[model samples]
Target: MFSYNVNEEIQLRLLELRHTDELFALTDGNREQLRQWLPWVDGTVDTEHTKRFIQSTLAAFAGNNGIQAGIFYKGNMAGCVGLHGIDWGNRKTSIGYWLGAEYQGHGIMTNACGTLVNYVFSELNLNRVEIRAAEFNTRSRAIPERLGFVQEGKIRQAEWLADRYVDHIVYGMLREDWSMNGQASNRFEVETDE
Candidate 1:
């Protein structure tokens, strides 16, 4: 298992089968709010769905393609952040994340994202990381903006959220840019279950 301590109050842990119940509860409880920006909320109708999702993430990690980690706040699961998939040939990846409605306004996603960005550059040696958010999702867009990511462009009708199509605003960060911005410092301790 891979776990990272983001701070005294926040931690990131690889999602596992054991987390299915907790994860499902969180999602089920926040269905309406999460459905606003996340398209998968409707698909995840039970713990079984959450289990399958975790299984896939574990497979991705095993293949060195990407990771999906649960964000923990004070020892409780709060949300998730992850790399959609790694393009090893291009040395790049995209990040995706969401938090429970109750976890909003705490800067948890921002810190988790920053930590993941650092890990991408320093540990994975990835040259670039991209984040795409719905054009109207200010909260999601703010994470990359706060982390100094450059606005690359916008994709028209990139995603269909429930009944409507939403444009996506793309943000990208390069390794050189992250280093030059003085964000290379490792602010968290990483632990691997051995």
Candidate 2:
């Protein structure tokens, strides 16, 4: 599990069923803001559903499959960040994240991503991590650029969402690159095992 306080105004907190209610509220509050990026928001979200979702995530973490955390700004849930579809044998992981529109353009995602990537490299000992985003999502694309991740390639029609296929831009960074850049923050370790 990971935990950290970002200055006095925000924190990156790990998720648990205990926080499911808050998570559901935040997700629901940001549904339209997240709909473009997240398919799960297509349906209604309730405490029970989100609670079960969190349970599944915890179970995945317990099985060494993935981990998800709630983004907190000033003690309130803002959005979600997660590492999923992990391939431990290959020493690789993928990051997925979103912030409420209200929190966008505040450098919150950059800070959150930097904090998570540092943990992934230094703590989890991952060889490489990648982020895939819709090609036209400039805000999402900017994260990799700001974080020094190289745009490896584009996977054409890689994902089908909302009845349409979309191109995905793949961006990646390695531990060596991260170390060379000295952008790794010494915070919590990335727990692939949750």
Candidate 3:
């Protein structure tokens, strides 16, 4: 299991099928808020949908592709953060994340992302880590910006939400940049050894 004990208040754990109910409930409760930026909100209609999503995440881990973890705030489900996928040939991976509506303003994602970037560039030795946030989503875009990610460019109509296409602002940090800038090196204790 991949678990990061980020602090006394925030932690991240691997998503499992057993967490379907809790995860689904979180998603259901934030459906309106999430639907604004996330394209898959309507599709995640029940626990079974969340179960299959967890199964896929597990399979990705087993196949050494990537991972997704459930964000825990004071031991409660908050959201998720993970590598969307790894480009092994290029040693690059894109990070994706979302937080529960109520969890905003706590800086949960900023620290969670810092932990993941540290793991990716330091431990995994990945060359590049990318974070793409929808152009209009200021809150989402701030995570990478606060962490010193360089804005690469914009991809028009990158994703389709419920009603329309949203442009994505790509931010990238290279291995050299991470080392030189000291991007995400705050203390994040791992509960389980990798």
Tens-digit lDDT track of model 3 for 1-194: 79998788999899988889999999999999989998888999988999999999999988888989999999899999999888999999999999998888778888898888988987788999999999999989988888889999999999998889999999999989887886656743323111
**Could you tell me every candidate's TM-score relative to the true structure?**
0.95, 0.90, 0.94
The number of clashing residue pairs in each candidate reads: 0, 0, 0
- In lDDT terms, which candidate is top? 1
lDDT of 3: 0.88
User: Stretches of candidate 1 above 4 Å error?
Assistant: 186-194
Per-residue lDDT, model 2, residue 106, is 69
Winner by lDDT between candidate 2 and candidate 1: 1
RMSD of each: 4.8, 5.1, 4.5
Better of 1 and 3 by TM-score: 1
| CA RMSD (A), model 1 | 4.8
A best-first ranking of the candidates according to their lDDT comes to 1, 3, 2
Q: Write down the TM-score for model 2.
A: 0.90
lDDT value, candidate 2, whole model: 0.80
Which candidate should be chosen as best, given TM-score against the real structure?
Answer: 1
Q: Each prediction's Cα lDDT score?
A: 0.91, 0.80, 0.88
Error of 2 at 93 (Å): 0.4
- C-alpha RMSD (angstroms) for model 3: 4.5
- Candidate 2 residue 43 Cα shift, in angstroms, is 3.2
